[model samples]
Structure formats: structure tokens, C-alpha cells
Target: MNHQDHQDHQAVGASVDRVAKQVIDAGLKVHRALGPGLLESAYEHCLAHELGLRGLPVRRQVPMPVTYDGMELDAGYRLDLVVINFNARLFRDGVRRFAL
Candidate 1:
């Protein structure tokens, strides 16, 4: 990669790290407030709420489609949550993405 592209990649990676930290902290706060007596769905909703309160955009229960030979298939993969931001992984241009 060129120097500019390398710098951009570094910036995106740093951003992902920072956002992940924020999300982790938010989830921890939720867990601390409400102990582990609830269902997974409860934790999921609360985490989303907490992140939203922090002004972060979050997508939940996102469908994951597998592609093969220009065909997209429903492979039963799903992301529990996706936090959208410049630091978040993007799959545009047929690129594989990392979790944030």
C-alpha cells in the first residue's frame, strides 16, 4: 500500500480500537447495574440502549449473507450488534471486515 493508504488504515484501526473500548465500557456498566439474572436478549437491549445514550449509532441483529460465484446465500450468520462509525469495519467494495 502507498503511504497515504497506510496512514488511512492506521487511522481506521485506531478508531476501531477507541470505539471498541467505548462499547466495552458501556456493556460493563450495564452488567454492573443489572447482574447476570436476565436473558441474553435483555443484556443485548440494554447494551444497545446504553450505547445509544452515549450518542453512538448501533445496528442490532444484522443479517449476514454469504457470497459465492456472484450469488448471495442466507448462511444463517448474524451479527448481534453493529456500531457504525468511521472506525467501524465496512464491507463495501467487496472487502472483508473486522469486528469492532
Candidate 2:
């Protein structure tokens, strides 16, 4: 494999989460099934297949445009994972509030 190919795979390899170990396991399962002969798209589809079996939401080719001054900036990259509305709650004086 070329250096760039090695870097590409490394870039997508994230630290496995204990709570999300199942996700990583699912990815590995896909990898094992397809092996290394297929293209990246095939691997992604297989991974998504496993994730779907686990009732996980998988959005492909999700566009994540950056915004500046209320203008949408079409950056060249997209986010693989976008978790929205994960803000924690804060309670003080018997009042519930959203944490920044």
C-alpha cells in the first residue's frame, strides 16, 4: 500500500469507545466479511449494513457546511459524525436549564 492509502485508513480509524464498543465491533465485523480486496465504498456500505442491523442511524455522504456571519460556507470536507442536541442540562435553585 502507498503512504497516502495508509494515511487515509489511519485518518478514519478513531479510538474505540467503551460504551460504543459495539459500534467498533460492528465495523470490524464488516471488515472481516469483506476483507481488504474491495474499495472503500464497499467497506463503508458493509459497515453501514452492520450498523443498520444494530438499529443505529447511518447517514451517508452527509454534507456539513460551515457557517460564518449567517452565511453558509461550502467547505471541502464533510463530517462523519454529527451529534446534535447533546447539550447537558444544568439545575440550580430548582430550575432546569441548558448548559452552554
Instruction: Give each model's clash number.
Output: 0, 0
Which pairs clash in model 1? none
For 5-80, candidate 2 gives per-residue lDDT tens digits of: 9986565443213315656688778887778888877877777777778766666656656779998788966644
- After the best TM-score superposition of candidate 2, give how far the Cα of residue 99 lies from its true spot, in angstroms: 28
CA shift at 35, candidate 2, in angstroms?
A: 0.9
lDDT of 1 by residue, 1-100 (tens): 9999999989877877777788889988999999988998999999999999998899889887999899999999887887874543544432335454
RMSD of 1: 3.8
lDDT leader:
1
Which candidate comes out best when scored by TM-score?
1
Pick out the ten consecutive residues of candidate 1 with the lowest summed lDDT: 87-96
Instruction: Tell me how candidate 1 scores on lDDT.
Output: 0.81
Q: Which stretches of candidate 2 lie over 4 Å from their true place?
A: 1-19, 80-100
* Model 2 poorest 10 in a row by lDDT: 90-99
* Candidate 2 overall lDDT versus native: 0.57
